[model samples]
Target chain A: MTVGLTHFLILGTILFSLGLYTVFAKRSAIAILMGIELMLNAVNVNLIAFNRYVAPESHIGQIFSVFVIVVAAAEVAVGLALVISIYRDRISTNVDDLDWLKW
Target chain B: MNFSLLSSEMLAAGLGTGLLILGLIAPKTENRRGFGYITAFGLLAVLVATFFQYGINQSTFHELWIVDDYSVFMKQVFIVAAILVVLSAVDFVETLPRFRGEFFALIVYALLGMMVMASANDLITIYVGLELMTITFFVLVAYQLGDGRSSEAGIKYLILGSVSSAVLLYGMSILYGLTGTTTIPEMLTKLTWSPILVVAIVMLIGGFGFKISLVPFHMWSPDIYEGAPTPITAFLAVASKAAGFAVMVRVFLLGLPLEGAVDWMLLISLLAGITMVIGNVVAIPQTNIKRMLAYSSVAQAGYMIAGLMSMDAPGVKGILFYSMIYVVANVGAFTVATLVRRALDTDTIADYAGLGQRQPLLASTLTICLLSLAGIPPLSGFVGKFYIFQAVMDKGILWPAFVGFVMSMISVYYYLNVALYMWRDDPKDDRPVPVPGPAKLVIVLSLVVTVVLGVYPGPLGELATMAAKSLF
Candidate 1:
């Protein structure tokens, strides 16, 4: 029952699946952004676990996770800005309301 | 590391930053028209500097960055695309109420991102470059403050784009775990097929598929293309897709053991076939010109993917050559659409009635561009199609090539429908469509390049062959 690579990988996969579920199920745009952040964090967990267990001598995975965090921040910043803009226009943040262009 | 190897990237980055600073320092009363010219000329300088780096096969920064003829050639395609977009966008940008200078700056930053993607040799480098390009595009797509469609498009792009990046990164992490390295060349040496590796490859394809807008993952594209500013749409069609293909070729062909344990060719051929059929068939009914072009570009991407079926120098050469021609033809078509949108304040196909009478230059250029896209003879698109199909046939993969050929024929129907509307119908308005000097230059230049490349593709063909050889 030790917390090994398998344990971390299972945890990561579950987080990723839940995040994807949130992305698909959520109607609010902000909620979708939160789901994306969770998915990114799932990736971070996977990277850190792999770096620790599989390639302990190198720091590529750790560094990559750090890069992922920074990029996710930037993405959220832009996403929130876009959401605010949409909110201003329609007073709504529901993904369903974004039907001005035909899908 | 020889810093000279980074000269082009540095120049592009500096130009983007310098433009932002210029925006801040310049008087608000001063017109922002100069920003477009400065961006275009700066990109031209960067393009020339990239040419100087040609034939230098080397890697630096611990193999994170690479410089070779293949990357150099792709960098040129991106710069040429950026230059055309900047020039065509000058008039369009002038119409924007604010942040006009920032428009040019963001385009330059996107160009820088594309250049980095072209040269990236490590998965980390590729991820960084891809995000830089995609994030900048999110802003550019949403730049039109008054247009709700633009903001909606931005939100759609941001959500999907981030999801795709996460998928791609997850695949990369898995690959790193299995191979214990992130350098593409190193991974090639270390890779062995396992069930997990299959999962990783599928994730990677899904991620890249979204970027290139291959059929099933292509749902977001037409909406985004229709809503984004026309110039940015043009950029998205030509440059962004080219970057995706360039990196896909590198990663799939080089990083993976495609020759062993996986029939990646069969998988890719299936996707390419479906993409061609769906993209072209769906395009036939679109009334909006931007959405039509979006689907057409998707079909065009399918044809390019057909070239990848071979995974050899000839296949790679076909892709490189076709991408260059695609930049010319798509920019030409989109520039014409931009002008039409500006003059008429609409992008409908039926609205283009009697355009031949009102603006013969635009009507004719649009016809040639669309005809080229439809792969008519004596046009660059025909030659591009020829090379791609020829490469696929040489590999003895008949079905995908056949599918591509038939799709091209199907595409001709809608393309010519627009031509017919332009030439045959009566004018909705009698006013002449005024063409700006820069727009006129872009149209004529695209026309000349398209024709010249078709008539004699030998020089570029040789260059493409050389670039393709460098990859192997």
Candidate 2:
């Protein structure tokens, strides 16, 4: 049996679910950022697989995935900066500690 | 491609870059207030440039960028928001420890992103523009380095906003896979009903829902609003939400159509109803003024979403009209709040006692703004609500409209509670609230627009109708 589009989509969905679970479960801000990166990577997988199989005539999906990769990198950079800033003040990156503005 | 078509965006980008260079070259002792004035005037130029392009309907970059009345109208809304924010933020920016130039420049960059969203004709363009705006806000939200709350708000926004963008991208990938295209107009013809399509639509809603701060996805807004600088909070409430609505309309109404695909209207209406009820109900008990406005803006988003039930020109028109007035009313309210925060250095509602006696201008402006938000008769907010509900009623959707009507009534209580504190209670301190010149101009300008638009919404109403027609 040959590998197919459905298989790739399943892998992508699994990665996405894992990432989302990480985001919800993780307490550390850095871990949450990692989870976001994983989710973005899952999207990249989906985009590439779709481009390879469905729209091979044009490279829009591949191009979109490239844009996603770049943006994900930028987002991570900003996230790390924020995490470092918060860590300097509170000495912790736990999201639960961010209750200064809560109702 | 006709470069002239992108004149406004180019101008905004140039202005942002110019400000950064100006900051570097200017003498260390020089005041940064000049940057604010330059940014405001530059945006005013961009706003005028959009007016010249208003009636044009064209697309470029292989139909990936569009120029039409719809985009022009939305661009004007964003530019007006940026201008008001910059004007009011001049004094606030001067108080920042450092990076004052970056504050104004980042706002312009965000405005540029919103303009791009207004004209984006492809999913990729939309995603890029959205990220540009969000990333800048991530920095802006955290700009107050000495304040832990500001930094906390920034990180939280970054994490949640990135996740939402990822979810939105996943949905876009599915859409491209199903349709084999990324262009919205191309996808329009290729779309067919499937279970996966429903998943994609839901993901899209969830993503945009977060951007507009719709209920359930709005968890980050109050924290962010309360922590960020007041002018930036106002900018988020007015310009960012409007940009989300603009793209949502383009994607759902124009691209997906949803005629034979799914009954997404039921889903949207359900969300809209809950958003109104929960937003207003939760807002009633908030002691902090910014947090209350954050929840109130969420409820306002629900009212705008109700207009989407009609899926027609009239509904779109109502949204545009309401967004315009929302910019005016919300900025007015936040400007007063900004002054109050600066004076008392506190955001608690009780701190505002007897503001009517101390500084009648600030108190009266805040009252009018809150009244407008509460939808009192003869105010622009009331007229805006009427248009939205009437559009939904015309569509024969009664429950969401009725829920909106009742929730807005519930909203009046909290809004008036703040008003009563200002007017009825004794002063905490006898010293007056200082009204800076630019902020005073913003207040009076917003007040006039709020009142005049309520009295005669004819011209703007017609313009909104025209913009709505162009979308179809």
Candidate 3:
């Protein structure tokens, strides 16, 4: 059986689901960051596959995917810096520890 | 490149970059008040420039950026919000342990994001503009690194915000796959009702729901509001949420096929109803003022969404007018809170005792702001609510409007409760609460606008109507 757009979409969906699960289940902030990265990668895959199969003439999808990669990188950098700052203050990277502002 | 068409955005970007560079070269001990003043004045100038471009309709760069009455009206609101934030923030920024000049510059960058988001005609531009704004907010929220709550709020906002953006992106990808274009109008032409399209739209709405803090997606707001600096909280509450609505109007009203296969309006009305109920009900129990306002802001968004669900010219006009009033009223309220927080180092409603006697001006200003937010007559919020309800009533969507009206009445209890604390309760410590000059100016200006607009809303109303007309 030859792989096609449907197969690529299936793989992308699975990766996205796993990433979302990791984000919700993981305690460590770094692990959650990894989850977010995974989700973004899934989106990138979807973008490229669509660009190749659906709209091969226009580079809009390709350009959008590139922009997504750049934005994701910036988001992770800011996320890590914030995590490190919180870690320095509380000495823990667990999500539970950052509950100072809870109702 | 038609430089004249893009002058306002260019001015904002140039000034923001200039401030960033100046912030680096300035000495550590230099007073940062000048930076705030420059930012406020520069933004005001840019706002004036935008007024000249208001009637000149143009779309450039592959139709990604459009200059029209709607964008111009929204840009004016954002510029005004930015000016108020910077002016009020001068005293607060001065009190930080380390005053970085980039604080002022970051605000300009965020304002630039909002301005771009207002005019974004393409999906790619919207995504980019939104990320630019949110990323700047991440830094601004954590600017006070010595404060633990600030850093915690920053991290929480970052994680949640990125997840939502990724979801929004996934939705955009699906849309692109189906339509094969990122341009909103082109995609609108090609859109057909498919299960996948519904999924994409739902995901997009869900993503925007997080930004505007409608009910289920609002878990992070109270924490972030209670933790982030007061001015930044005010920014997030007012300008950022307005941008979200701008995108919503652009995407849902203009881009999506509202009258076609899918009934997105009903879904939106459901969200609006739930949001109004939850936001008002939850606000009643909050003792912390920022947290309380966070819930109130949520409820406010619900009211605007109710107007948006009308999906007509009147509905869009109501949204525009309501957003303007909300910026003035809410910003004024937060300015008072900021002042009290500075004086007392607390944000509890109980601690606001005897504030009326101690600081008559601030107490009165806060009262006006809160009453306006509660939709009391003779204030801007009342007129705003009137417009919104009238629009919804026109569209024959009475349930949500009834919910909104009842919620506004319920909201009056908590809003006036703050006034009760200020006026009824006796002073614990009777030292007068001093109001700084700039902050006092911000409060007075916003209060005047609030009342002035309430009494004679014809000018802004006409502008809002004009702005609404541009969408179709």
Reported per model, the fraction of native interface contacts reproduced equals 0.74, 0.83, 0.83
Q: Which stretches of candidate 1 lie over 4 Å from their true place?
A: none
Clashing pairs in 2: none
Off by over 4 Å in 3: none
How much lDDT does each candidate structure score?
Answer: 0.92, 0.92, 0.91
What fraction of native interface contacts is shared by candidate 3?
0.83
lDDT of 3: 0.91
Once fitted onto the true fold, the runs of candidate 2 whose alpha carbons sit more than 4 angstroms away are: none
Which whole-number lDDT from 0 to 100 does residue B280 have in model 3?
94
Residue by residue across B1-472, what tens digits does model 2's lDDT show? 9878898999999999999898899987888888889999999999989999978899999888999899999999999999999999999998888888789999999999999999999999999999999999999999988899899889889988999999999999999999999999988889988999999999999999999988989998999999998999999999999999999988988898577776677788889888999899999999999999999999999999888988999999999999999999999999999999998999999999999999998898898999898898898999989988998899787887779878888999999999999999999778778999999999999999888888898999999999989998
lDDT of 3 at B281: 93
How close to the true structure is residue B18 of candidate 1, measured as C-alpha lDDT? 98
Q: After superposition, how far is residue A27 of candidate 2 from its true place, in Å?
A: 1.8
- The true-versus-predicted C-alpha distance at residue B252 of model 1, in Å, is 0.5
Worst 10 residues of 2 chain B by lDDT: B257-266
Give the per-residue lDDT of model 3 (tens digit) for B174-274: 99999899888888788888889888988898899898997889898999998999999999899999999998889888788865556788778888999
